[model samples]
Every structure is written in C-alpha cells, then in structure tokens.
Target: MIRVEHLCKRFGDLMVLKDINAEIRRGQVISIIGPSGTGKSTFLRCLNLLDQPSGGRIEIDGEDILAPKANVPALRRRMGTVFQSFNLFSHLTVLENLTIGPIRLLGKPPAQAATTGLELLRMVGLAEKAHSLPDEISGGQKQRVAIARCLSMEPEIILIDEPISALDPTMVSEVLAVIRRLARQGMTMAIVTHEMEFARDVSTRVFYLDEGLIYEEGPPERIFDHPQRQRDRDFIGKVRSLSYHVTTADYDPYALVGKIEGFCEKHLIPHRIAHAAQLLAEEVLGVLLTPLAPPRAVPTGQIVASSALAGTASTGPPLTVKVTASPAPSGPTHPDIELVLAFSEKQRSLEPRLDGAGPPGNPLETANLPDDFALNLIRHYAADIGYERVGERNRLRMRVQSIAGREAVAPIPLVRQCGAGLGGGHELDSATDGDPTEPDRFGRLARRTPATGMTPHQRLSS
Candidate 1:
C-alpha cells in the first residue's frame, strides 16, 4: 500500500538513501538486508516520515506524503514502526504502553483501547505480563510489547528496523517468532535484519542494499542462492576469494601462499584443508605452470620478483590464480575450495594437458617426469579437476577435498576439456599406490610413488 519513487535521504554531506524505487504491496513481507551504514534503517524511517527524504516521492495509498500540505501524521497512523531500541515509556505498564498509542493518537476510549491492547498482548503471547512494568520484562518481552503497541494503532503496514539486534542471542528467537506469526497472518512488513536465515525464510521479497542504493532485489532464493552481483554474493557469504597474478616464472610463491593462508584463516577453513590449498598453489604454480612459461634467459647478476617485473619490463602472458572458497552444499564444517588457474595466453603448444588424449609419444610420458609427482599430488588432494579453454585463456580448475577422513576425495576421473567448443576427455587411472592408510603431517594419507622415491608429503616439503 506504499510506493516510493526516486527516494533520496541525505544527512549533511552523507548521502544515505539514493534514488530508491520500490513498492510495498498489500500483505507483502520485504526484508531489507545489507552491511551496516548502507541506510537500511534510514529507508525504513523515511517511509513513516521519521526521517524526511531529501527528494523524490513517497505515496501512501495514492496520497503523496512528501508533497506540500500532505497529512504526514495521518499517513503515519496507517503505518507503525518498531525501532531497534525498545521505545517504550519506562514508567508505563506493558498494557498501558500498548493502549496509550491508540487512546492518545486515535482518540479511542480507555475501555475499548484497554480491551484491544490486552488482545494484542495475548496475540503476541505477553498476556500474563500485561501489567508488568517496561523495566521488569526481559529485552525480548519489551520488544514484543513494542510490537503489540505498534499493532494497537491498527496500522496497515509495519516497518521494523532491526528489532532483535539489541536483544540477547537467547532472546532473539522469541522476538523473531512473534514476527513470523504476524507474517503468517498476512501482515505487511518491511524488516531490516541481519539475520540471514530468518530473512531467507520469512521474506517474500529480499532487498540487498549497497553504495546507497538497492543493488539487488528478488525472491529470497534468487537473492540468497544466486545473487547476480559480486557485492551481493560477498555480502550474503556465498563465496569468498583471494586472487593473485603471476607474470614471470620468478613470481613470489611465498607471498601468494601467505595470502591464501590469510584468506583461509579469515573464513575459518580447517587447518588440513588450508594446508592442502597452500600445497596446491605451490605445485600448480611452481611445477605445472612454470614450465608453460615462454623460456627466458636470466641476466647473470639480476634477480626478478613479481613486483620488479611490472609494466614495460614484464614478459609473456599473465597467469591468474584465483582461489575461491564457498560453503559446502552438504553443510560440512569446512568450506569447499576451488582453485582456478587462468592463463592469459592459450597453452596448446607449451605443455601437454593431463587430458590423456595425446598420442603414445606424448611429452608427459617421454620427459622422464618421475611418475608425474605434481599431478599425482594434485589428484590425491583434489576431489575433482578439469581443464577448459575460453577465448585466448586456458583455464584449469580444481576442487580441493576436505581431507579430514579422506572420504570426501573421489577417484581421479577423466579430465574433460570444456568451453570454447573443446570437447572429448581422456581417463586417467587412480593415483593411489595401495597405501591409503598412512597419515602424513597434514593429517592426510601419504601417497608414495616408488618411481619418484618419495611420498607426497616429502614431495611437498622438497
């Protein structure tokens, strides 16, 4: 029953809500979620004229509330707001807090307001605490009393601004339960909440605000599961990433490893999985990828680091290593890690892909590589691996396994060439040497290759 077009709110030099356009239809529950300082609360306040908009139109049931000579007080009576802090009168009893609004603002008789107030208290499950002072009840009870007070005005729409943010964690569920009941009974609500799961479950529409605008808004599933924008995805914790570029073969692998470790620690990835990620980066960059670089001669007295090779002095195409960690679909404690290696130049002629489709005299077999230590090590720690070519770039993707019990790792499958019409795949045998029982320092089974005269753990260390 409310339509906001090009709504803008500014506090001095700070622009809070900018060009916001949305409509709150009857019985629609729209949840506004975003990082703090994104003006979610300000947008809600502007709806009821608590914060005056700097520009644009706010129409309530065909009446322009922001227009000159508009009945703002009358417009607000049709909407009720529940603030983050419980704004109850400290001296008033719970029933009085609920009845005072309808009696004073709507001019209802004390007897009728009292009857309606107690019914709302009972509806919110605070009937027994009707006579309790505001200070006597817990935070959740006070918020519920505040909600009932809002309903006592008999508002057509409710604007709740982070109602449970100030409450104790144990008390949060109770307040949310009351809001959920109201939503079920077809109450129109615009909730500003940080409770991601609650918003996903209760909201018919979800708005993700960023940079002082509605960045994305859609059904809960689309907004939460498949956010179309990067900021939206990051805000909702769908995926977290760390990226680095390697131009020359002399790029600092240690610095890249440090970044990977920091990202893992920040996201609470398990120690074993984090170590696997580091190992993957080391082997993929130092071993498999370094050989693909165009051969370059080093000057006798010069050393090159990544930072020193920037701008005009850089050579060859850059390889970007992007490590993305996303929550596992199975809801495990560890997130699923995907390591993507994108080569700016296609490597069709540089290195033989693990795609096994080459002739019998392939370079991989003839190069005396000591049983392909790097590839075997990658397969041991990876749940799946694939290769694809996109335009000029050849991308290799690997999904790291959570090696707690070794059950998450699947058998090494055929590496299929995908994207850009590169088809067909070649199957590779499982790299297991029938020694899956030995645990290494990283708490994973040490795969020992007799040809290499070393275990995977020793290979990693060496």
Candidate 2:
C-alpha cells in the first residue's frame, strides 16, 4: 500500500505536481488521465522517487521514501516501472533483459534468475521470443518483454506510463491485452495513460488531473459518462470526437451500426433523434454494401428503375464509416452529426467519377447519383451530402438535422425535399409489391430490388 500527503514537485519556478494527495491500496488499479503536460506522468515518477519530490511525504509499506535514511533503491525495487519507450538494452537478448535485473539487483543466482525469467516471459505470452534481441522484436512485443522484465523482480506494485503509446496502431492491442491480463490477475498498478477507453473499462479508480491538480476523481462511469465538472465534460467530448474509428466490412453490417449506436448513446443523443440518426446510418451503409451499376443519365422518375436494380453483392473492399459530433452550426442549438464514409482504394472499371455525378444545384438534384439506391437513401435521410476523392479513398460527407428539430413529426419522413414541410410520414411497412426484398427495421431494402412502394417524396405528400 502507498500514500501521498501534500505531494508537490517543481522544476525551477514551474510547478508540475501541486499539493496532490491520494492513496493507492494493494491490488488496486488506478488510472491517471489528463491532457499532455498535465503532470500525470510526473505524478507517477514522483511516486517511485524517479523524480525527487520537492516537498511532501510518500509512504510505501509504512516507510517514508523521501527520508534521508530510507533505502530508495530497495523501496523502488518493491515497485516496477514500465516506460513509454521499451527501454530494453539493445544488445541484450529477451531472456537476458529479464534475468540481468534479478541476478545483479537482487543478488539472485544466475540459474535461479534464468528460470524465473523464463517463467515471467511465459506469463507475458512471449516465451518463444526469449532468444530474440530487442531490435528483432516488434514495439508491442518489446513492451510485453518490458512488462515481463518488471515481473522478473517480483514487485508488489507496477507503474506503467503510457505502455502502449509508442506502439503502432496495429500493435497497441497486443500490449494492452498483456496489461489487461495482469490487472485481472490482481497486480496492483498505477498507470498514466492516454488510453481513455481502456482505463474506463479496467481502472478501479480514475484520477482526472487538470493543470497539475486532480480536477476530478471517481469511478470510471462517473468520470467518463457523468462527470460533475464542466472541464471534464469538455475534455471527454474532445477525446471522444478525436478517438472514434470503426470499419464496416462488406458482409458484416452490424460492425458499423454498433459503433454508431455506442457513440450516439455516449453523447446523450435524444431518443427521437437517436433513432432517426441510426436509421439514416443503416440505410446509407446498407446501400454502400452493394456494388453500383455504371453511371448513366437516368431521368428522375426512372432513377429507381435504372440504378436501384443493378446493385449486387460487392466483391470490392468494405467501407469504413467514421462518425463524429461537431459543435452545431453558428445559430443551431444542437450538435451536428457528421458521418464520413471512406470507400476502398482499389481501382475498379465500375467506379463512378466524382466529377461526373451532376452539376451544382439542390443537393437532391446535384448530389452524386452514380447509385440510385445510395442517392435516394441519403436524400431521404440526410439534410446535406457531398463527395470527393481524398488520396486513395473516396470520402462522402453526410449531415442531418438534430432530433430536437424534428421530434414533432411522427414517423419522420424518409426524405424531406428542398423547402418541404414535414408531413405525410412514411411507414416502415410499405408493401414493395414490385420488389420482393423486405425492408429492414429502418426501411432499408434487404436486397437489390426496384423501389416499388410509394416514393419517398410521394409518401411525403400523402
């Protein structure tokens, strides 16, 4: 167990940790979360005397570590620290990295240390890499080896400072998975990390620091979802907006929908608008799953007949849909829901040219109409739509009115034409006699079929 009393750390005239007081109990996992340069890592460093505290008392197992007579090295040995950089000796093999500390620092026999090192490597799921050099392993693997080396000392508590921060996007999960396992096995830890979602899911207690002080501290649900402080809310919102990324594969539609659902729920989306927004996402994503027929100048009335019937199971890569909530327009009272769907990079003979879709005018008319199904679906559900080529990906931006603005209309219309009032609601049960494909809960066609039932605009007037 450890305790901090009036903890303070300063570099010259600049204070990094100010009058911080908190307790870390045995077997407890505490996460320190905050923006960069907020003293989160500094607090962790001060705990182990890696950075001497300017003034304050830090007691570990009833001994004040800052005392002149206290054995700082021995006390620190009881706690292990994992840094952002792997910090493994480049010349040492994985097994050597783990064994060297125990043999030299603890004075254990080389044979005993080697056995313990092998066991620690096995615990971190890196037994096979024991012979590999630091440079031979991946960033994630090296981090895992770092954790294993820490365990080789048999420390009572672990200090992890952004253990996954240096890893590639693809390697982060592996290292986190190792840490998560350690937590499950009851390893006491104090982590300073930018992994908010991981901390929310794993931490027993959360310390949200701001300006070198614990601005808010509590359980993850309270800190992450229902923070009592305005700054906390703003921080959480900014983090959420920047951190969300989800990929929806061609055959699996639920992946994207699930992400949207979780995102909307987290943002406290209104019930009426939430349902409509989700429906809009489902319809748009569903249309994207199917392959579009080559573009042609089809008349408005025959649009459904010409393009809607040509969509089939696409063999191309899946779409990646990213949704983020932005501050509402200059005069609007609610947040703006923006959805950006990124298509595959593979060149295709059937791909429609972005410039050839239409001329500038009303979005419903001027919007890209390469695929009638997608065009109609967006026009019916979104207030704005635009398309462009970004690098190797084709990106589409879609926006819709917040639920607060449309809750008065029951069974919200699928499409509200330019300047049209919300009237004649379209029912989900419309009979598509011409096309046998059944509509989903969101009224999206189950398969490539002619748009039979009443047209979105026609239903708006009835």
Candidate 3:
C-alpha cells in the first residue's frame, strides 16, 4: 500500500534518513529500532509527508506523493499517524475527538461520523470514556482515544512513532494491548519503538538503523538471535548486559565450569577461548573452596598477619563471578574478541603494590606456594590480569583476547580446546599434592600447555 524509494531527509547540514527504501504491504508491521537520534521518528514522519524529504520518491498505489503536483493532503488522509504524545485536542470530548477528523476531512455526515466514532471507541475498550475530556482520562485511555480518532479516518496504513513512550510504565501494556488487537484485526502498521520484546513479537520485519543507514534488517529471530555484524552484536550486548552471573558457596569449581561452557557454546564463542574461560573459572573457584588458601592479607609491605580462627573456618563468604563476552573496543590497539571475568571477594587481600615489593609479591612475578596454582593457570590461559578494591571487597579481573584473522592480523587466540592449539593446558594436579580433598586444593582441567607457562620472574636463574 505504501512504497518509499531512495528516500532521504535532512535538516540543514545534518542528514537523518539516507537512501531509505521500504514497502509497507497490507497487514504487515515493520518496526524501526536503533539508538536514539538515528532518525526512526523522522523516517516515520517522512512517510506521511509530515516532514518533507530532501530527495527521492514516496509512492502510494504507484502514485508519486513527492511529485510537485501530488495531492499531498489527500494522500495523508489515506494514512493515519499516532504520535509519541497523545495528541488529542484537550477541549474536545473523546467522542468528538474521533468524529472531528472524519467529519472535517472526509465530509461524513454528523450522524454517520458519530456512529463510527462510538464503534471505534468500543473497539478500543473505551466506550465508557467517550464523553471524557483528554485530561480527564489516564495516559493510556488518552492514547486509546488518539488511536480510535486515527481509525475514525479509516486510513489504509498507520504510522505510529513511539506510541507508548510518553505513557507510564503501568499504562504501556494497556496501549500495547490495543496495538496488538489492531495488528490481529489486519491493520497495517509502521512503528518506531524501543520496546524490544514488543517489537520482536509483533513486527513482520525489523530495521536496525545506524548513522543514517539501515545497518541491518530481517525477521525478528535473525535480527535478535544471530546478528552477523560486530556493530550489531555490540549494540545488542550494550542494550542487554547479557552475561553469566553465578555465586558459588559450596565451592564446586566443576559446576561453574559447566555453566561457563554452556554459555560459551550457546553464544558461539570460539572453542579455544571457551576452554580457557572454563579453565579460568575452575582455577578461581577452587581457591575459594580450599581452607589452606591464605587469609585475605591486609596490605602492609611484606608484613603478613593471619587470623587464627580462619584456620578452622569451614566456609567463607559467597564468591560471585560475572563473565561478559563482547566485541573489544575498536582501535589499532584492541583485539577483536574480549572475554572478561570479574571475581568479587568479601575477604581482604594484599593489594598488589605498584612499587613492586610486597609479601604476596607482584602478581607479575611468581605466586607464593598455593597462589602459584591460580596465577599459573591464568597466565597460561588469559592475555592480561588486573586487581582492584571495590569498596571493602576485592575484585580480581582477567581478560582473554582473541583476534580475528584478517589480512592485517595478530596471531592471538587464547588457549584453543584442541590437543595441539594455542595454550596447551596442563592439570592442576602437578601444581599441588595429589589429594583431591586437600584443604588448600583447587580444581584443574586438561588442555594444551602454553609454550611459556611461567612468567620471567618465576623462572629459575642458572
């Protein structure tokens, strides 16, 4: 019913919509979504000539609405628009609001317009609110009246721009329910919305706009579940902090490994990074389970103090881990894939001194006894490590870098799972005595060991 070809809309030197082309068929709902200011609303406005385009053609039924001689007003009458705000005449009653457009524009008789207005109000479940003024009704009711007013015109297509954005959260669902009913009744719609789930559920097609271009468009499943572009994945991750968050109290390092593996496989993370991530999770959680692990050391030079009762403590504060997989920041210096692991510990630990002298010593150097196991595992699997104090809690972080293979590339893929790839991991059994129930014991995994597992500082000098 509507065709927009090579459409471009610009304001002054700023271009909003560029070379946009879309077809809105009867009963098909196309949703435009993106970060704010990408021109979703402007594109919707351009469709109905509410905002004149800078270039290109807009057609309805093969007639160019952008033509100088086009009957623009008449064309607009054939399409209804619902704005973000409930744009109802405050002086008009709900019934009158619906009838005025039909009576004024369509020249329908008062009696006929009234009859149709009442029917539309009923369809929107606002029959009882027909006599209420705009301010006299809730935001949702006002929006329903606005929708019915648009329907009273009986347009072939509806353009809704953030229809529920101005409504209260409690009222959003009410308005969405009405829109859903309209979709079910075969009313064609083009919407600009930030309501992700709603758009995914109702849209026949989804358009992701960025920097004045349709970056991606497809069925909801493809757009949401399998975004092929790096920008798309980054945008999705930013919008949805989609990560694996787990708190382990019983110190089941293997259980955490299972969770990490599942998340990586489901998200299609490379096998190498997934294996390294799983290994890292096991190593971190194992330390929490072991009673022999040193008490959180207070930062006081090389001076180390111990809590006597800590030796008898059976359990510790819950260990919380959050892992997020995202595209690395783009630059000449950043890698392609970044896996971040955040470990939050309630107990105190010696802060790694920047001056390079301390009891726990520099994490850059050899780990003292038990600490050696974790530091070794992480050094072998991950590319970088960091530690900081968050409030009273200590947070240990690790970042694994996996670079994409391109013409200009760096050979960096952390610990691939296969027998002879990246970091060939070894068992933690070699790091500790072979007692599975050892008080200070952590867990281990089997993978290729890194060619350089020990840091230079940890190496024995001849």
Candidate 4:
C-alpha cells in the first residue's frame, strides 16, 4: 500500500538516507536489516513522516503524501509505529494506553474503544494486565501492550523499529511471538531489527541496507542462503578467520598455539573445541609439516638439517596455516572450525595432473610414519580431513570437532629429535627468532615475511 522512489533524508550537513526506493505491499511483512548507523530506523521514520525527507517522493495508495497540501496526519492515521523504547504513557493504565489512540484520533466512543482495546490485548496475551500501569508490567509485557496499542488504531500498516533491542534475552521471544502472530494474521509491516533468524523466518521480503541505500532485497531463502553480494554473504555467514605463516623449522609452535587459543576465546568457542584446534595446529605445523620447512642456520654458520626422515628434503616452500570459524549451516549453537595448511614444492609441476582427480588421496597416508598415535590422534579431533592441489601449492583442510563427552585423547609425547618419521618427533623450540606480531581485525598476521615464489607441489602427490 506504500511506494517510495528516490527517497532521501538529511539532517543538517549529514545525509542518512540517499535515493532509497522500496515498496510495502498489502499483507506483506518487509524487514530492514543492516549494520548500525546505516539509517534503518531513519528509513522507517521517513515512511510515516516522523522524519521529513530532504528530496524524492513517497506515494501512499497512489497519493503523493509529500505534497504540501496533502493531509499528513490523516495519512499517518492509516499507519502505526512502535518504537524500541516501548513508548507507553506512564500516567495511563494498560487499558487506557490501548484505547486513547482510537478514542482521540479515530473518534471512537470510550466503551467501543475499550472493547477493541481488550480484544487486541487478548491477542497479545496481555488481557489480564489491562488495568496495570506501564511501570507495573515487565519489559516484554510493556512491548506487547505497545503493539496492542498500535493495533487498536486499526491502521492499514505498522512500522516497528528494533522492537526487542531493549528487552532482556528472556523477554525478546515474547515480543517476537506477538509480532509473528501479527505476520500470520496478515499485518502489513516494515520492521527494522537485528534479529537475523527472526527476520529470515517472518519476512516476506528482506532488505539489506548499506551505504545509505537498499543494497540488496530478496526473498528470505535467497537473502539468507545465497546472497549475490559479497557484503551480504560476509554479514550473513558471520565468517571469522586467522592466518599464520611458518617459513623455517625454527618457527615457534607455542606462539602459533597461543594465537589459536586467543582466536577461539575471542569468538566464544567452547573450551573443548578450542583445545582440539590447538592440538591440530601443533600436530599439523610442528610435526607433520616440520620436514617441509627450509633449514635454519646456527650461530656457528652451519646449516641445521630441517628433517632427518629418509627421502624427505628441506626443499618445500613455506607453509601457511589458516583457521576459520563460522556458525554451522544447521544452526548457531555450535560453530564449525576449519584449518587449512598450504605449501608448495618444485616437483609436482613436472607431472601432469589428471582432470577431476579428487585430492590425490589423504596426505596422512603418504607421510611415512613410524606409529599410528599421531595419525589416530589427528583423526580423533578432526571430523573431516582432505588434501587438494591448487596450482603449485598443496592444501590440506581439516574440520575440527569438539572433544566433549568423548574419550579423551592424550597429547602425543614430544619427540625433540628432528624427523623420527611423522610421529611427533619434530622439535618445537621455546626461543623465537622472529618477533610475535599482532593480527589485524580480520585475523590475518601482520609484519611477517612473504612466502617465496610458487614452486612444485612436493609434500603430497596428486
């Protein structure tokens, strides 16, 4: 019933809404979502003329409401707004709050207004509190009353702004339940909220606001599952990642482990899961890939061998470890952690790779081992592991799983002597030749030496 075209809103020198265009169809629930300060609330206010536009046109029912002679108040009567703060009159009783709008604006008789108010109150499951004052009720109940009050006016459409932002976690669901019921009952609404799952469930159309405009708009499935824009995908997926580089055999394993732990804690991952991630980093970098690192030179100017494992040479390029954490596709209760190890060698380029050949098989099988402890321990903590060749680099990906409630896997005994096979024989020195550096907000390590030019893939055969 409402259509906006090239709508713009400005306050003094700052422009908030720029050339915004959207439509709210009858019985359609449209949800506006985006980062803060993106003008989500400002857009809602402009629709009801609570915030006047600096330019552009808004047409309600084919009538240009922005016209000077158009009846703004009369037009607004057809639209109701519910604010985040539950703007209920303190002096009025619950029943009075619901009835006053209809009585004063709609010109309804007191008894008729009260009867309608009581029905709306019942719809929101707050009829028993009809006589209670706003201050006497809980935050959730207050918001429900506010919604019922908005509905008592019998408006054609409603605008709700961050309806549950101020409520406690326990109270959020109650207010959302009321709104869900409204959506089911065919209430045309434009809601600006941060509740992603709720918006995905209830909205007929989702609007992603960014850069002061409707950056993307689509059905819930398309918006949440397969957003076409990069920003939308990043925001929807909630992806967080960290990367560390290992150039030489002397690279400090403890520093890498500490970084992993800090990343997990920052993301609020479970302790069991965090421990598993640390173990994976230690094994993959310190033990499994130690033979692949370039040799280091000692103070005596003698080059220390990187690996003592037979047939294994220190000819492989530097390795990069990347850790990414994201909410599971099924739900958000448990997040999924991914570990990727990438390194290149000079030999793989000499052989032709078969098309569609999957992963050249798992690297764990090819790495000659003396025992199964390290291999089995790796398998215990990792839910899935695979190897793939991308260009000259060989990448191994592991999906880390939680060890909670499962049989505990003890850490492999450290083997200080260089390569005694791929069985935790690699040494992890406590002294660091390179200084520890801070990672950027995106979790990528900074002030690190770049990896050498791409060579052949030698660690894993394709």
Best lDDT among the predictions, by candidate number: 1
Ranking by lDDT: 1, 4, 2, 3
Per-residue lDDT over 1-462 for candidate 2, one digit per residue giving the tens place of the 0 to 100 score: 999998999999999998888999999999998888989999999999899999999999799999999998999999999999979999999999999999999999999999999998898888999999999989999999999999999999999999988989999998888889999999999998888899998899999988878889999999988889756765665533312232322324466566656655666654555455556565544333222311344333221221123375434322111111111212112212234321111210011112112122222232233333444444445544555544434444444444443443344322222212122212322424224366432333434325544444333233
What is candidate 1's CA lDDT for residue 265? 68
Candidate 1 RMSD to the correct structure: 15.1
Candidate 3's residue-wise lDDT over 1-462, tens digit each?
A: 888888999999899988888777888988888889989889989889999999988899999999999999999998999998979999999999999998998999999999999999999999999898999999999988989999999999898989899988999998999998888888899989988789888988888888787889898888877877645644554422123333323444555566666656665566776676676655544333222233344332221222233465425332111111211222112111112332212111111111111223222222222224354565555544554433433345444434231213332221211111111122311332223333211122222226644422222110
> In candidate 3, how many clashes are counted?
6
- Global lDDT of model 3: 0.63
Q: Rank candidates, TM-score, best first.
A: 1, 4, 3, 2
The predicted structure with the larger lDDT, 2 or 4, is 4
Which ten-residue region of model 3 has the weakest summed lDDT?
348-357
On the 0 to 100 scale, the lDDT of residue 425 in model 2 is: 16
Residue pairs that clash (backbone atoms under 3 angstroms), model 2: 380-414, 380-415
> Across residues 338-427, which tens digit of lDDT does each residue of candidate 1 receive?
333221121111111222111132221122222234555665765445554344344455556656535654443222101010111111
Q: Which stretches of candidate 4 lie over 4 Å from their true place?
A: 240-264, 268-462
How does each model score on TM-score? 0.63, 0.55, 0.57, 0.58
Write one digit per residue (lDDT tens) for candidate 4, span 77-143. 9999999999999999999999898889889999999999999999999999999999999999999
- Name model 3 segments beyond 4 Å from true: 238-462
lDDT of each: 0.69, 0.66, 0.63, 0.69
